[model samples]
Target: MKGRTTAWLRKKAKRGFRGYPIATVAFYGPTGDFATKVVASIFPDEGSDPAAMERWFTQDTDVRTDAEIGEQVIAFVRGHAALSIVVTDGIIGCPHEEGIDYPDGTSCPKCPNWAGRDRWTGERVH
Candidate 1:
């Protein structure tokens, strides 16, 4: 997988994504232990097939389909600041997991489908 990603990065370079895109995941367990951690995830993969992405669920930190996930995580960690509960967060890529051309099956990227359906729940992302 790493080798495949390296080759993919080279391809992205030609497309003008010269550097690695930033991606991070934060989570607050049901127990309320707030934490935030940065990750080098979400590479520029040319193929975004579900079969290929299914494997990524293990190696990559999956961001649940929630807007402002990063801000929520940060709030959980910092408790109270001047910002208060006005937490705000956004993924490095406003829209993630793009550029897969599939005919029979759905795409694996986390963003909304081209038709505006939720990739996970099949609901409208908008």
Candidate 2:
């Protein structure tokens, strides 16, 4: 599965991706303790199939050591924020403004208001 996904990513790269996208899963314990983490970042040389990746994530699985912990993490993200996790609790004045679009409609990566940066902390997002 990893190889297949990687190949897809390579294909995408050949086509072109503005930035390398990735997926990370953070697990927690039954009591809601942060347990472990997994990141599928080593993609193939080119591009990837977004739909396939989405299916892989949304599909039911028991790969985690603690199923309950996984469930809790999923629920927390779903309830507290959008599917994209943005840690804003401790950042000053966080929950920063949205990313600004360039005159051509693309996001301005150099903009101070870029969504990828934690406005309050000036920290780079993962």
Candidate 3:
């Protein structure tokens, strides 16, 4: 135990960073090789999964505000044991702008403004 981490562990311990299940960062090892591993406990800020947000924005019709959208997304994600998703375009319908033909919430014969959604994928980028 002359130069072991466990022996050092038994000594006075300094608080380490706290974000568990975090993305692994590469670092040079004692053998001069790059490696990755999760060796500590760090409380995550509950990562913002864009995929989950996409799912919620597509499925749930009750969410309107960006805050509500994000909250519902996190809730839905936490409910599932695991989930994986990918959207081709991160931005959906172009918001009302100069050249875009996106339906403004005003004259939408299909849906409401706050509930403004992409009818195809049902993702509200507007």
Candidate 4:
């Protein structure tokens, strides 16, 4: 069941845009290979910012495959009555927020693996 919840979530997302109260799911980690953090944001309506945002983190396991975390994420989206769910296909970037976790102009000190890498493609950038 490690991947069951993730599969379910992705399946839901594949249904396409249904309506308002959309939930966006994104994963982050030190490197693009393993997701240590997951962020879920809820938008109550179109052209509006997320009204609620929640984050889950794991130190010893990938959050993507963690059954408990996956359940919680599913529950959170359901609780918000989200009509649409959008999940990122893969890890997007470092788990650390640049301005919040480190100096805005500098790379994350804790995640050198993501430095100079494109978050979307995971490719080295010039």
Q: What TM-scores do the predictions have?
A: 0.17, 0.21, 0.22, 0.95
Clashing pairs in 3: 18-42, 18-43, 19-42, 19-43, 20-42
Clashes of each: 0, 13, 5, 0
Put the candidates in lDDT order, highest first.
4, 2, 1, 3
- Give the TM-score comparing model 1 with the true structure, all chains together: 0.17
Against the hidden true structure, what lDDT does model 2 obtain?
Answer: 0.31
lDDT, candidate 2, 1-126, per-residue tens? 124432332343355433333322322111122222222222222365432121112223322434444444444333432223222112232111225323443434433343455434546674
lDDT of 4 by residue, 1-126 (tens): 157888888888999999989999999999888999999999999899999999999998888888999999999999999999999989999999978999999999999988898989989996
Candidate 4 structure, TM-score to reference:
0.95
Task: Say which prediction, candidate 1 or candidate 4, comes out ahead on lDDT.
Answer: 4
lDDT of 3 at 25: 13
Error of 1 at 71 (Å): 13
- Tens-place lDDT digits, model 3, residues 31-110: 11111111122223356432222222222221222344434333443343222212121222222222333444353232
Say which prediction, candidate 1 or candidate 2, comes out ahead on lDDT.
2
Q: How does candidate 2 fare on TM-score?
A: 0.21
Kindly give the stretch of ten consecutive residues in candidate 2 with the minimal lDDT sum: 26-35
Better of 2 and 3 by lDDT: 2
Mark the regions of model 3 whose C-alpha exceeds 4 Å error after superposition: 1-65, 91-108, 111-126
Model 3: how far is 62 from its true place, Å?
13
RMSD of each: 16.0, 14.6, 19.9, 1.2
